[model samples]
Every structure is written in structure tokens, then in C-alpha cells.
Target: MGTRLLFLVTAALANGVALAQTDVPAQLRVEETRASQLMPILHHLTDIYGPRLTGSPQLRQAQEWAAQQMRSWGLKNVELQPWEFGRPGWHNRLTEISVTAPFQAPVLARALPWTPSTNGLIVADAVILMPPGMPAAGRAPRRTADSIQAAKGGVAEPPMPKMNASPPLPTRAELLAYLESQKEKVRGAIVLVGPPAAPEPDFIPQPMRRTDAEWMALINAPPGIAPGSSTRPTVEDGRLTRDEINATIAEFLVKNGALARVKDGGERRGLIRVESTNGYGATPQVPGVTIANSDYGRIARVLQGGTRVEVRMNVQNELHPDGSTAYNVVADLPGTDKSDEIVMIGAHIDGWATASGAADDAVGAAVMMEAMRLLKTSGLKPRRTIRIALWGGEEQGVYGSQAYVARHFGSFEHPKPGFAKLSGYINLDHGTGRPRAATYFGPQSGAAIVAQKMASFRDWGFMGANTASFRPVSDSAAFYLAGLPSIGLYQDPFDYLSRLHHTNFDTYEEVYEPDVRIAAVEVAALAFALANDDKMLPRFDANDIPSRDPAAGPRARIRPPENHGEP
Candidate 1:
């Protein structure tokens, strides 16, 4: 908070008028270590059922398991509501890749999510060339039109582009970066990869944050970074063509998967998290991590520079048709006097096929579950019905919530009920950080007193309401699009993100009990207060309309076609 606001807050506290601190009872203790009955429930969802990839058999099993668990929890009307989605499923079984020839050390690699695995140890000669320019596998000659044109100019015939070019594994980090840099067009080599590592906000920034062994190695330079391990100080020599980089990564994935190559220790390691793992492409067959120039030189000398290297790898996986039988786990805490009105809290249950969906949403789901579980267990029934929705197919889009809104708020496209008797919506989807209040979509004045109370969670030192403003991104966006005011709560993404997030590293070990407990209290307290409060969160009264016409509109405007072969 700014100085003036702090002063105002201080002044308000001194007055003792008790303005907006209505969300929690003065006696509620929101400290870390507060245990919930639902903790074990969340564990089973994450540990037993594992990753609930949308549409997969195991995913379906998980969905059913979630519903059953909720039913066991005594939730009413618990059922798996079916919806259509992409068919089939796939899961990895075997991933083995090794480099043969000049030198060899185990390498770090992974397979793209949803990629067809090679049945056995496939072998191929390594080739390191850029995209749309490298020739197909095993084709000795560059006879393309461009090659001919270049040859006439004595332009040392450029390496032919890959005709048998297979899809590459793209990372979430790269995709987000590309989108940030350009929006006019988003294309490159096709990728079947998974979410990349979201950088850890703190440890990653600390240069000396490495272990004693790592520090010694960095300082000595005698014993270079351990095999398949990376060292500090990454640098890019010159501006590299984005297309070139994309091709390089793509080729790396193909060759690595086919046992053509293994990446040197020039790349960084992956992070693991509790309750979740970004397993999208966490295998020894995919590509994203690249070797450092110094080390890559060794492999380049043999592969790109002509010496042939032999590598072998095997990828085994199962395939399932894409089908979407959507389901949202919903429960109710009926209100005494205002049972008709509703207060809703939610977090998505579906996760990236790669992750365990823990932090990305498990924490959020757990938070939502624990909030209601705490209220009910504590014998604190709400004054208005409190609804909890663990939505399905959220990763595919807000299909679950959208379907709810479209049906519950009939004429949603035309606006009949504006909201679903929704006093407000509170959502959590960020990784398992501590409770840091929330970000809303309104002027400070609108939530003035509430913001003050929200900040009170800060008293615990781990929880504080930032009162920052953020547009909708998760399921809340569906509500926001329907003109309902929503609040997105978050914790410090310091470790939860970089450490676990969506990688295979996302495991139960990564969750900080103190942090998760802190979050649970804050979220429950917020829900309880909101349920008992008199006023509803402010809504967007100005120009609230469906973003686009269902029939057709500017949103569906035409775009120029891609010039396939043109540079």
C-alpha cells in the first residue's frame, strides 16, 4: 500500500468503527497449520488418481473418483454430467535415449504430450539444421527449387529443409514469449510438446544459490558441470532468427526421440511440485532444453559437422479418442433465511495432461473444498447457499462454467439474469503459494472497506490482500464475461511455480503445509464473510454484452491465408 492509503487504513483502524472488516468474525484465528478434514481427500485426488488428463481413461477414472469422493463427503446431487470433447487418450510408458559415437553421457530429454511413441529402439543418424531448410532424413541431395536457385548463384546449396520433418515439442514459456512478442501470426514447426518450466522467481535469480558442489565446480572450472547438468551465466551471442531457433529445437526433439541424439548438460533441470506435476512432456524423448554452445560443440563436431553419431530411444504410450463428457463437482451449503441467494467459490479440476493438476489447480480446488468443508465442519452454516464447483474441461476452455452460465443464466447471450444469483465469485488456480488476499476487477473505492478487511489477513504475515487489479484468465473469466464481479486469490508464486508447477517434479513433496494451511484459512474466511455479508461484489454496469455474436461478427472476421512456401 502507498503511504497515504496506509495512513487512511491506520486512521480507520483507530476509529474502531469496524467499517468493512465484515468477511470474518473477529475471533477467527487464521494462522498456518490449521488442518482441514478435506486434506486427505485432496491427497487421494492427487496421489491415487494421479494426473486427470481430460478424456483419458485414467482421467475419467479420476473424474468419477472425484464425484464419488464428493458423494462420500455428503455433497448433494453429485453426478458425472457428460459432455462431448476430443476422443481417445495417450500415456507414456518407455522413454530411452542415448548418444553413440564421438562421446556419450546420459542426456536430459522428454517426449511431447500426445505424441505417438516409437514402439522400439529406433535409430537414426543425427542432423542439426534449421527448419524449412534442412533436407528430409536420409536424402543425400538438395534438389529443391530453392536449392537450385541458390546453386546457380554459387550460394553453397543450403541444407535442404525437412520433408519428413516431424512435430516438435514446444514449451509453455516459449509460446507465451512468442505471443508477447508478436500476435500477427503464430506458427513455426508443429509441436506436440508440453508446458515448459515457469522460472522460479527467487532461487533462479540468485547466482550463488547453487549447492556447495555446484559452487565449487563453477569456481574451479576444472571439473565442468556434472554430466547432464547445467551451470550459470547463460548468454546468447547474437540475435537468432526465431524460425531458426524453433527448427533447432524441433529437430532436437525428433532426433532425440528416434535415438538420434542426446542433449549435453548445457540445459537446466526441471522443477517438481507437490499435488501436481507438469508431466505434459516430462520424458526422455522430448526437446526444449538445449545444450550450451561450448558443450554443444562436441556433438556438433560429430553430427552437424559431418561425423555420424548413432543414438537409440523407445517411446511407448496408449492412445484414446478425444471425447468430452464434462462434469463439475458442485455442492451446496444451504442458507438459513436467504437460501435462494448464492455465493459461489470454485477451482478447476481438469489439468494439463502432463501435470497432476495440483498447484495449477489442485491447491485452488483444495482451497475451495476446504473452505466449505471448514464452514460445515465448524457448524457455521451460511446465511446464503454457498456453492462449490470443481469444474471439468476448464483447460479446454471454460466449457463447464460456460455451460453452467448459459443454462443457469438462460439468455446469457442476451442477458436475462446477468448472474446466477451470484453475490460474487472467488477463484483460486495459481500454484500453492500462501494466502495473499486477492486481485479484483474494480476501482479501489468499490471494494474500499472490503479491501481494508482483506488486507487484515496480512496480519498473519503470510496472508495479505494486495488489492491489485487483474483481468480474468481462469474460470472466473466466464463469470466476468457474464458481468459478474469476481475475485482471484493468489499466493507468492516464488517456489510453487518454478519448483513443481506442471513438470514431473510436481509431487506431494513440494507443497508447503504452512503455506497451504494459510491459504485455506484465508479463502474459507473470505467465503464465510462473503456468504454472511449484506452487499454483493460490484459488477460492470457499463456496456456489458456478450463478447461476440453466436451467429457471426467481427470476432469471426476473415484473415489472409498463409503463403505456404514463401519466406
Candidate 2:
């Protein structure tokens, strides 16, 4: 009887090992297939649906399509959760700009979203307003009848006159002075404003996946040293306060009867960087447009040479009422044992209207959807429920995620019953880069737990995990502020900052198939591990708050100097 029992025990152990070996490769293959097959999903979200500005009809369509897709994939509890977004809805139907005087040429430009539209086609003389401290170029010499007669006599014409160098933009006081002195010149003309003061370089190095040693140090470091200790210098003081200076400029231009305000495009290679209209909650004082730098430079040269420059522009935009409700798409895959516990993953679904927001978030959304599909279809029934939330108003201020947390899990100031059941929240909104590591924003006690949970996937190129104070930039900010275990996936830069982020070039082609596929596999594996973990992830003590306001809601109270909520 003892020999028979030993044989059965050994056979059971062998079968368990075999199952474990088979599970990894099988799940990996499923994710691989998902990665390669993501093009159709990408096309549908970006190409077919087009730009999904929050609260717009297109975004509503996208939310419906995403919810339907989730349901079709067998995800349960699929619904479009509504939230109050305190902003007016806006859409741009038509925009056109061209140079009509001194030379006829097309000028590439895009109207700022949500700004007031030109009543109709406006043809006005262009005026280049140079800043203070720089001298304006002298007028070019004109050819007289005597000069033409002399040139006809075969004598060399007078040497061409030299043009003075372009001037730097004016300071606040100088700008005020220019506006006062040239008020009439700027009035009734399309004024081209110079770029603002150059900002200081961002010296902070981009974060990569944490190494094992780094993770160990994070677990051992004292409070205020590891997280929330960044002493990065800010350029906020150097910036012209938008409401004070920029708004004054806009008001002054409008009061002076300016037809439209055109600014030089900051982007290189003809890329038009578009943004929302100025002055939230109110229509802009004047219509605004961003002209390509090359064309703008040409106009500036002509104006400096004392030549009249004219431009023709037409912009058609509409603003809906402010009370329109935005929605977040939510779906779930039920768990088995600890069904009440939850592991959540999300990406923002809304994007700017200038381009298909493929790289900014569509890639992350696709990965989340595909990961859920792989786990569900692969027959992996986790011990805890897995929830997927495609957020709205993230681009605005992470309103969708904040509203979700406040409604379901309660805000930091007010804890609810659902808060305790949450195991962890994972977010991937950076872009379509490959996932290399993760940053954990929970209590120090949870570091070891995360490390152990992530160890199995080290072979898949996970750099391990490190504890860091969360920056309230992405949707993870809301979860972190509430002291829940939250994480942001670290990824390769992949031109997300330099080129594609929020630009017209952010289209479907920016997706790198192999890298995105790897990211999908990593995200799916992480979600599965978190869901199946035995214990709930630890949270920071209520008093141990990060360097941010817990009650600030979606708009992160602490914004970086470079991004002062311009959009």
C-alpha cells in the first residue's frame, strides 16, 4: 500500500510540472497571435472612427464600438459608464489658410480646437510683430526710372542692399509697449506673433525598467529619499503667465480689430502641432491659427522688407453646451475563488482631433483589449476579477479615471466599501513603445510582493519593479493619490516625446508591430499574475501621502513647468 501511494504521488507531481511548462508557451503563443492580428483593431479605432475628442459624437461612436468589441470577445459586464465632464463639446469641420498678396501660395495651417471660428473667408493684410530688444530690418531699396535707365546702359546695378537680422521676441513689458505703439498697425490686420521665450532644457533622464539592485534599494530606502525626492528645477517662473500675459495679448489684439491671430509653428519638417483653444469655459477673444514655420518665415521676411503681405483664411468650428456627459468604456472578466477582489488595467480612449491618436493611446488600448482576449480565450481563469477600463477625458485632465475612482472606489478623502477589494491597478498610456519595466507607487511593503509576482516574466525582458512616487500625469495618478497599489508601465521612448505625441503625425503607421506585441504579452502576463496572487497588494498608510493633493481630482495639482495645462 505504501509503494502504491508513493507511485501515485510521483505521477501527480510530474503531471503538475508538465502543465506548468505547457501553460507558459501556450499563453505566449496566444499573445503572439494577438499582436500580429492587431492591425484590424487599430484600423477600426483610429482610421475608421477617426479622431475621438472627448464628448464629441465620434468619441461616443468609439466607446460604443469598443464596448461591443469587448462583449463579442466574451468579456462580461460591458458598459459605457458616464461621467460629468465640465467642458463644452467642440468639433472642426473645415479649415483653410493661404497667402494672397506679394505672392499667391498655399500655407499649411490648422485651427486650434475649440476656438472661435472666423465668420467667413477673411482677407486681410498681414503684419509681423517683432519683439523688443531687436532692431527691425530696413526697407529694401526700390528700383527707380533713373536706376532702370542706368542699368540698361550696361553698367552694373547698385549692389543689392543687405537685410538686417531677425529680432528676438519681446519681453512682457516690451510686448505691452509694442502693442501700445503699434496698436493701429496691428488692428484690422492678421498679426503674426513671434514664439515665446525659449525654455530651459529638460535635464531629467528618461526612466527605464528598474534593475534588480534598484528594486532592492527602493524596498530598503527611507521615506522622502526614494520617492518624492526629485529636486528638478522648474521654469515656471520664467513662463509668461497665460491668464496674465497671453490673455492680455489676445484681448488687446481683439480690441484692436484684428481679423485673426497667427503664430509660427514650433514643429520642424512641416508638422503642425495643434492644441485646444485658449481660455477654458469661454470662447477665445479672437480666432487663432498656427502657420507652418517656413511659410511664416517667408511672410516675416516680406513684412520686414516693408512689403505688404496679405493672407486669406477661413475656419469653421462649433461649440456645444458645457453640460454634455462623457463616457468611459468598462468591461470585466469574472474570477473564480476571490471573485470580489479586482485587478484593473486601463488606457484612455479619447484623443486630439488633429490626427488619429494611434500612438498616444490607441496602441495601449489595443494591447489591453488583446490581452484580455488572450487570457479569456486561452482559458485562464484567474482567482480575482480582471477589469478593463477605456477612459475618456484623460487628455483633458484624467477626468474619466478620476470619476470612476470617485464613484466606485471612493476618493482619497472619502473611502468606500469597494476600495478595500481592489488588489492593484495597472496603466499603459505612454504610447506604443515596448514595455521594459514597471514603476510601483504603493506602500514599501508591497515592493517584495510585486517583485516576486513579476519574477516569472523576467525571462520575457521585464527589468523588475521599483517603488517611486507617482507623477499625477496619467490615469494612474487617481489610483495612486487614493493610496491604492498603482503601477505605470515603463517603455522605450520611440519618439513619443520628440515627434508623435499629440501631433498630426500620430497615425496608425507609428505602431511598431514587434514591440507592441511584446508589450501586449507583458501586460497580459502581469494582469494574470496580479489577479491570481494569494494576498491583496499592500497600500500606503493614509498619512503617507505622495507629493500631491489627494482631493485634487482629475487635474493634477502639481504640473510640470513645461506643461501648464495649455490644452
Candidate 3:
């Protein structure tokens, strides 16, 4: 009887231990199964609030809405943190572009952000001037009547003009000279200053769908290096930067009586790709539009074939002056014992107006918001405060996040008390896909800690974690540079780069509901684990981190494509 009783007790104890081990995953599973909650929140942001361009009224409205939502969920200290984004605010009211001469057709286009109004309906002759040195199709090797007859008689004709032979791009001086010579003809015309729109290829490179091994490798790699990592930028020789060239061209166009400037939207199909100006706090001198590549190509070919073209442009855009204040939405779930220590999760709230900015960042913002909601509703109290920051002006230059970092934790170049109190930061900005892994951008020592924490949710698609010491390309960059542990979630690429990101196609329809649900659950679980951890994540020595070259200021780096906005 005694032996039988002992066996029963041992069996009960084993069962109890198994149940305890499964508790976290069980909660996470419940969260994932109920992940559908994200869809409505995403809809409210993308469908109802729409595009949240930085410094625009719409963005402010969205920020207010987000804060109110957080407050409703019982989050503490929910507020809009204001920052001075030096750039002027812009909003598009109306835009209409149509070809009038050669053939009448409506040309689909969107005014680039911050582009000035056309004043009134500006109907002008369209002049296609190839930026100096772009090859003009050489006159097909002159076909003589004898050569034509020979070819007709099955004999090979004289070799055609070398179609590929073209001169090197002209120097800045040469470009200016060419424009000057054409002053009489170009005055008051709508100049097509865009490069020749290349024909769409049969296949475009796609983002690698992350495999299990690839995801695991990312988590386990050391800092400052990862698969497909590129070398840091260095100061260049005397050649003028692309921004300089563009600025010069813009100024010249405005000075020379140009009505407006039109460029081919470098997007697949006829989709529009919009971008903002490069000015720190100014608007473009003249109106600019990015038209569909197909339409732009048609106009260019007509012009090249010696046919006259005329276009009518009507744009109404408003620019709020400098000193405009943009905001970052902030709220926190207060911690118990370690309230002073912080674990931050953020996503940029600002995006271009081309679409509703759904995939580019709305999904990111929604994921963070949903994750916070889950933690609150799950009745789990954390040790360190969990803060959610939805940053504005990220599309501009990571301005909002940088300002927040500077104000709260001091600049990356100068550390403050709050900087050390930061346990770590995790950012989500890749897209609407589920989080498969984590990327660390600080000390390599922290990778082990992250890996151990992430191991708990391995079944929830926690592949692994990795480290790098490069400057961040996202909001976490500020924290990373400040010597705090920072991480970004690596997500599956569900056509984010191929079709939806920064284009008109980035709408609510493109969002994968199931994936977003999984993302919210994963993000919430990670935040919970990080905040509840007993020890703060380790930081690396500044010397160990790869510092930006002093001479190579922000301008020297290879920036994302204009339409990419901010990562």
C-alpha cells in the first residue's frame, strides 16, 4: 500500500510540472487564436484614419485616435509627445494631369509631397530634354535604297548603328550649358526632366522568403555583421552628390519659367510611387508630379520621334511653414518593482500619401498597439515599464524618434541618465508579416540572453536572434547608437517590397489578417518576457560599436530610394 501511494504522488507531481511548463505557450496560443482583434484596429487606422503623413493634420488626428485607444485600454500616461520637425508640413488637395497635344488622354499621377501648387491651371508645351549625356537612339544606320534592296533580296544589310554606344553622363557644367542653350525653347514649358523610363523587365527580384535556417542564423549571428550586410559609406571625392544635382536642377527649372516638372514613376505597371522633398524645412520651388511609367514612356517616345506634345497640369498642395510641431504618441504600462527601467517597442506612424500607408507602417503601428492591448488584457504585470511609441516624421528622416531620444535619453553623441535606465528597445517596421526572428544591433553578449528568452516561444515561430554593430536604418537606430540594446523584428516578406510598399497598392486589402494576428501575439509575448526579466540587457562599449565616420556626415550615406520613405 505504501509503494502504490508513493507512485501516485510522483505521477501527480510530474503532471503538475508539465502543466507549469506549458503555461506561457498556452497563453500565447490563446493570444494567437484571438489575433483577429488586430484586423479591426488596422482597419480603423488605414481605412478610417487613412494616410498619416508626417506633420499633416491627418497624422495628428491619427495620433490622437491612437492615444485615446490606448487610454481606453487602461494604459497609463498616454499622450502625444511633441517635437519640432523643422520641415514644413504639406497636404495634397487636388491634382489633375492630362496630355493635351499629340493625343488627349488623362495621365494618372500624384504630386510629390511638399511640391508647390501650379498656381492655377498651367497649360504648357511639354519639352522632353534628356538630362545631358543620356543616349538618344542614334539615327538607325542610314538605310540607302541599295541596302534596302539588298536586304529585300536576302542579303545582309550594312551593320546597324551601335545602339548601345552612348556618351558618359555630362558634367554639371555641361548639363547647365545644355539647359542654357535651350532656354528659348524651354521657357514656360512643362519640362520632362526624368530619365528615359526603361521597359519593365519580365522578372523583378523578390525579397528572399525567410527559410527556417535563415531565420535561425539571423538570431545567432554576431553584431556588426549579418547576411547581405554592406560596408559603411565613406566620404566621396569632388563629384556632386545626387541630392545636390537634383537641387540644382530644381532651382534652375524654377528660375527658367518652367511651369512644372514631370518624371516617370519608377514603379511596376502603371502604379504611382510618391515621395517627399529632400529639404530639411522647405517646399519644392515648382510643382512636380510622378506619372505612370507607361504614360510617361508614351510621351517620351512621341517627343523622341519628333512629335510635339502638350500637357496641362493642375495641382493644389498646401505647405505649413517651418517650426511646425510633429508628434510621437507615447503610452506606458507601468511596472511594479523596476518601473524606472524601460523596455520600448515602437513603429513609425508617418507614411507617404500614395496609399493608406498600410503595409509600409500602419501594420507595424497596429502590431505594437495590439501587443500592448494583449499584455494589458492578459492581466500580466511586468517588472520594467513597457512603452509604446508611434513616431511621426519617420518618413522624413527618423526625425520624430530622434527628437524623442534626444529629449528623453539625450543624443547618441551625448548620454543622459535615462539612457542607462533603458533595458532595451524593440522596433517593428518591416511590414504586416508575422515575426519570425529578432535582430540585435548592440553588444554580442546580449544575443545569448535574447536567444534564451526567444526560445520560450519557439513553437510560435521564434526562429532565433542575431547581433550587428551598424548604424540603424530604423527608429531603434537612435537607441542602438546611444549604446542601449536595440532590436528589430524580422518578418516574412509577403509582397511588401514587390508590390505594396510605398505605392497605391499599399491598402487594407493587401494586409494578411492571419499573419498580422500572429505578429501581435509574438510581439506581445516578447515584450512581456523582456519587461519581466530580472536583469537589464547588457550594453557594449562605444569603442566596440562601429562608429560613423566623422567626415561622412548623414549626406554621405547611401539613402533609401526616395519612395522607400523610412524603414
Candidate 4:
């Protein structure tokens, strides 16, 4: 009887221990049924607030709305963290481009942000204006009619072009002189540039997800530098920089009373990509617009055929001179035991002005908000405080997160009070797709812990984790540079690169509901696990952190297309 009673007690203790181990995560998962709550937040951000350009009014309003939402959920320290932005805010009010003379046709176009308005409507004759071209070398060898006939008769022919021929590039002086000669032609005329060749249809299909083999290859690949990681401006032999040359051209056009500059939309399939002036604080002296490729091509063809083509351009843009203050939405869910330590999750709230900026980042912000809500409602108290940061000015150069990190955690040379207290930071900015795996910026040990914590989420598309020093050029880099452990969740490709990134097509319709909800649950589970872990994730030694090269100029700004290549 005593032996039987001991066995029963042992089995009961085993079952109790198992339940204790699984209860929190299981409860967290149960709370995730409320993950659908993310859609309303996303809708309010993308649909109601529109594009949240850095330093713009819409972004400020969105920041306030997000803060209110967090506070209502009983979060602590919910506030908009302020940062200084020297530039005035800019947004497009109206843009109309049309062919008036040759045929009545409306042109699809989007105004470049920070460009001046056309006052009202300006209708003028269109002129093709291309930047001066470099001089070419010797011409290709010609194929005579006799050679053509010989080839038809099965005779061998000589190679067409002379591969040995080469030519020196034109000097800056020559190029400027050629541009000076076109001043009269562009005076009072609408200038059209680019489309060196007409766009063709794309037949290749875009892959939705990276295969397990591809993911493993990426995980095990050697440390590679991300594009635009260097912050230096490119200057050719100390000559004029590209921005300087463009500024010279723009000033020249303004001097000649050019109506407005127009260019191809830079992508096929009628998608418009709009960009701002190179200098963040400076506004363009002359108005500019990027029109659909088809419209641009038709107008160029008519002018090439010696027929006079007239176009009408009407643009209205608002510049808020006082909109110099940028804010980041920050809030905290207090912990019980290790409340001094912090675990962070963040996403950028700013985007380009071309579209609603839904897929580029709004989905990320919504998922983070939902994850925090899930942790709070599940009644699972973490040991370390879990914080949510919605950053601004990411589209330009990740200014918001950089400023936050600098204020809270000092640089590699110096350490701040809060530096030692940070457990880790996870940033999501890849796209709207579900996270497939995570990449760590610290060490392999940290990644191992993350893999173990996230193992239960395998069915949700999270395969595993790996150690990688270089992270995608997102908000996480700021923390990584400060010697803190940072993790970036790599997501499936979906249509982010092909259709939604920084284009007019980045709207709510592109976001998939299931992907985002599952992503929230995964992030919540990981955060809960990490917060309650016995010890914090290890940080990189100061020596392990990469120091900036003094010779490189201020970190180069991130242009979405150039910087967001696959890891």
C-alpha cells in the first residue's frame, strides 16, 4: 500500500510540472484568437490616416492615435517620443498631367514630394530633354548586302562589332557645355527625360516563399554587407556629384522658365514610383512629376516623328514649415520581477508618399500592437518589461530609431545607464508576408535560445533561427550598432518586392489577413518566452561591434530599391 501510494504521488507531480511548463504559452495562444483585432488598427492607420510621411501631419496624427490605443489597453509610459527634424513637412494636394494638343488623353502621374507646386495649371509645348550623353567610340562593323546573301547561302560571316574598340569617357566640362547648348530648346517647354528603351511585358512569375533549402543556405552563408551600408556620397575623381549635377540642371531649367520636368514612372505595369529631393531638409526649386510609362512613351514617340505635342501640368503641394518635430510612439507593459530590463518590438510608421504605405510597414505596426495586446490580455506576466516602439523617418535613413538608441543607449565607445538593462530588440519591416525565420545580430547562443523559444511556431511558418551579423537596413540596425542583441524576422517574399514596395500599389488590398495574424502570435510567443527566461540574451562585446569608418560620410540614406535587396 505504501509503494502504490508513492507511485500515484510521483505521477501526479509529473503531470503538474508539465502543466506548469505549458500553461503560459498555451494561454498566450488562446489569447491570440483575438489577433483579428489587428485589422481595425491597420485600417485606421493606412486607410484613415493615409501615407504617414516623416515629419508630415498625417504621421503625427497617426502617432497620437496609436498612443491612445496603447493607453486604453492599460499600457504604461505611453507617449510620443519627440525628435527634431530640420526639414518642413511636404505632401501632394493635386497632380494632373495630360496631353492637350495632339490628342485629348489624361496622363497617369504622381508628384514628387517636396517639389514646388505649379501655382495653378500650366499648358505648354513638350520638348524631349535628355542629360548629355557620353561620346561613343568606333562604330560596329557593317554587314553588306553581299555578306547577307552569303550567309543565306550557308557561307560563314565575320563577327559584327569590334570588341577591341574602346573610348574614354567625356569630361564633366564637355557634358556641361553640351547641356548649355540646349538652354534655348528647353526654355518655357515641359521637359521629358528617360525611357531610353520602351518597357516590355514581364512574363516571369514572382515566387511567394523561399524554399527550406534557400532559407538554410541564407542562414549558413558567410557574413555579407547589406547594400547602402556605407553612408558616403560617391564622387567621381573629385568632380561634380550626381546630386550637384542634377541641382545644376534643375536651376538651369528654372532660369529658362521650363514648365515642369517629367520622367517615366521607373516601373512597368502602370505602377508609379515617386521620390523626393536628395537633401532631406531642402525643397525642390522646380516642380517635377513621374508619369506612367505608356503616357511618357506615347508623347516621346509623337515628338520624335516631328509633330508638335503640347502637354498640360497642374500640381498642388503643401509645405508645412512648422512641421519640424518628429515623434515615435513608445509604450511599455510593466513586468513583475525584472521590470528594469526591457524586451522590445518595433516597426517604422513612416513611408513614401506614393501610396498608403500599407504593406511596407503598417502591417508590421499592427502585428506588434496585436502581440502586445495578446500578452496583456492573456494574464501572463513577463519577468522583463516588453516595450513597443513605432518609429518614424525610416524611409529616409532610420532617423527615429537611431535617435532613440542614442538617447537611451550610448555608442560603442561609451555606454549609457540603460544599455545594460536591454535584453533584446526585434524589428519587422520586410513586408506583409508571414515570418519564416529569424536572424540574430548577436551570437549563435542567442539564436539557439530564440530557436528553442519559437519551436512551437513551426506550423505558423517559423522554421528556426540562425546567427547573422548583418541585418536588413531596418530599425534593428540602430540597436545592433550599439552592441545590443537584435533579431530580424525574415518573411516570405510574396508580392512585396514585385508589386507593393514604395509604389502606388502599396494599399490595404495587398495585405493578407492570415499572414499578419499568425505573425502576431509568433512574435507574442517569442517575447513572452524571452521575457521569462532565466537570463537575458548575451550582448556583443564592444570589440565585436563594427566601428564606423571616419572617411565615410554620414551614413548614406536608404533608397528602397537599392537598399532592400535579399539577405
lDDT of each: 0.51, 0.71, 0.73, 0.76
Q: Best candidate per lDDT, number?
A: 4
All candidates in order of lDDT, best leading: 4, 3, 2, 1
Write model 1 residue lDDT over 398-487, tens digit each, in one string. Answer: 667767766665433466553547777788876666654455544344345445546556554423232222234567766755656567
Cα lDDT, model 2, residue 412: 52
Measured by TM-score, the strongest candidate is 4
Instruction: State every prediction's TM-score relative to the real structure.
Output: 0.64, 0.79, 0.85, 0.86
Residue-wise lDDT of candidate 4 within 123-240, one digit each (tens)? 8999886554422211122255654564456645566675553233335685578678888998788887543334433444447788888767666656654332433454457466
lDDT of 2 by residue, 1-567 (tens): 145643554464446533352244344544465345566777888998868888777788888998998899899999999899877777777889999888999998877766778879989999866555432211122255654565456666557786556444445776787779878888788888763222222233234333556545544554332332222333344344433555667778888888888876655556666655555446356778776667777888888889998889998877767436889999999999999999999888888777888987888888888778777766678889999999998777678898999889984567899998999898887677776666777765676666666665565555656665435357876786566788777666676755667777889998887777777767777788878877888776656645465355322324323221210
Candidate 1's displacement at residue 288, Å, is 12
By TM-score, how accurate is candidate 4?
0.86
Task: Tell me the lDDT of model 4 at 444.
Answer: 82
> What does the lDDT come to for candidate 3?
0.73
Worst 10 residues of 1 by lDDT: 558-567
